[model samples]
Target: MSLLALTAFAAAATASVPVHSVALDHRGGTYKVDYRAAVETRARTIGMSAGTRPSTQRCIMTATVSVDRIIADGGHELHARVPGEKTFTRNLPGDCRGRAEQLTALVEDRQPAIGAHLAAAAASDRQHALAAIDAAHNLASN
Candidate 1:
């Protein structure tokens, strides 16, 4: 049936990609880019085979402050928050102030949405893997 085929395709697509891995090619900040790269690396290590990360452990995500010359021509106020911390304030230098602020704003805006997606996907994968292990253990014991 067409419905069955569609369902199969959907599952395959979902399996092929990590659920919350970000694809932000356009909004690359020097700091945000490096931060995102690390998250992407960790995302790849997850899934059915790679196994779940330990529950208690946590890691910092990095974001740097840098300006793009084109955007920096018109200076703007900047504010940004890194992951799991209160918003940090900065007094940027005059030359790249506009660019730096723009980058920070983009990073702060994108970080939460992306972080949420990654967290949810990672958790779902973790629970699914745990359930599979439990089922396998019971089957083996029987």
Candidate 2:
């Protein structure tokens, strides 16, 4: 194959693969995780326990991530590479699985940074709450 043809083929293959995108929903005040297929797993899910904000005052939110492999050929077996059998096998699309190692690394890489930022925010919120109480008490006494 000519070099130009090979380059085109590589670009096409790369374009076919999905990319991971993760962000915090600051405007809506929600925590959501989105990821592309990993190296060994597809449909990587990163989430937290429902109802706990990462910066929720007085609580530390934990990120829960799992990589799932979808069963092929009209099967409904979903395999978890990170959750360790915690995820019940459900119907999943074939294109979901990618690389488990990559997803794991993403989780590990993000958790600490997010935790630190949220920790600071939570502390600030706590301080504000305490100050409000103090101001209210002083007003009532006066």
Candidate 3:
């Protein structure tokens, strides 16, 4: 049906495109980093068997990581925290004036699993949409 087709098309379109965002926040003497991630899924088909029948469909995912905003805080102490983690403070090597990059790195180090989680969620949604489409197709053919 048209509804099924629309659902599949929407899922495929969303999986193919990468989202982008931009924001600016002015703050005095505070180090802040706004990180964003966009995940895209690609369907890879391996070698086909005899009679040109499709063997299997594989979902390969890629993530685009972006540092949306990085504001430098003026001080000698740097604080970094990620979701589900405790906040940690570190002393800057020389001074707190040029440690924005260091702060960002410190925070990013604890966020490597974010892309994986996003990919899994996307894959689950894609699978559900695909199942719905298949069910609809079978019903229509019968």
Candidate 4:
């Protein structure tokens, strides 16, 4: 789940009284996963003339493109060729199974880098969280 999704879930959870504490489970392993048959859509207006009414002249063009997303997990680290981007996707219109196999192979090739980057990011987040906790404790003591 994305961070925004998690934040929304947390908000909803806090709004109601829960009988038990929430636990988020994560799987730890080296793996490559691929999701295929994803669709990408883009819309744009075409043929706009100053003499013609905008609404009448406007045309919406849409195309459905098949895409596949691949991800590599190296325990705690993750690095991708596209810096600052979490996912790697490609346009592949083919059998889902075949596309997945190809995508997995691609992810496996970059697994090492992905793992390293993810680990660094996780460590940074952990450090920041600890610092925030320490700051809160010190403030409370004072």
Considering every candidate listed, which one attains the maximal TM-score? 4
Clashing pairs in 3: 75-96
Q: What is the lDDT of residue 100 in candidate 2?
A: 32
lDDT of 3 by residue, 1-142 (tens): 1444334433443332322222223322223322334322222223334557644432222222322222223332221222221232334323232333444443344344544443443333333333433454477689
Per-candidate count of clashing residue pairs (backbone under 3 Å) = 1, 13, 1, 6
Error of model 1, residue 10, in angstroms:
34
- lDDT (Cα, tens digit) per residue for candidate 2, span 1-142: 2455334333333332332323333323332222223222122223333455452122111223233222212222222222221111122222222333333344445544434443443333433333433454477689
Quick one: ranking by lDDT, best first?
4, 3, 2, 1
List, residue by residue over 1-142, the lDDT tens digit for candidate 1.
1444334323332222212322222223211111111221100011122246533322222233221111111232112222332222323322221232333343455455545544544434443333433454477689
- State residue 50's C-alpha deviation in candidate 1, in Å: 52
Minimum summed lDDT over a 10-residue window in model 4 is located at 16-25
Candidate of highest lDDT: 4
- The TM-score that candidate 3 achieves is 0.25
What lDDT does model 2 reach? Answer: 0.32
Give RMSD to native, each candidate: 25.5, 23.1, 24.4, 16.0
| Model 1 clashing residue pairs (backbone) | 31-64
Comparison by TM-score, 1 against 2, better one: 2
TM-score of each: 0.22, 0.23, 0.25, 0.28
- Give the clashing residue pairs of candidate 4, or none: 77-115, 77-119, 78-114, 78-115, 78-118, 79-114
Which stretches in model 1 have alpha-carbon errors above 4 Å? Answer: 1-98, 127-142
Task: Give the higher-lDDT candidate: 1 or 4.
Answer: 4
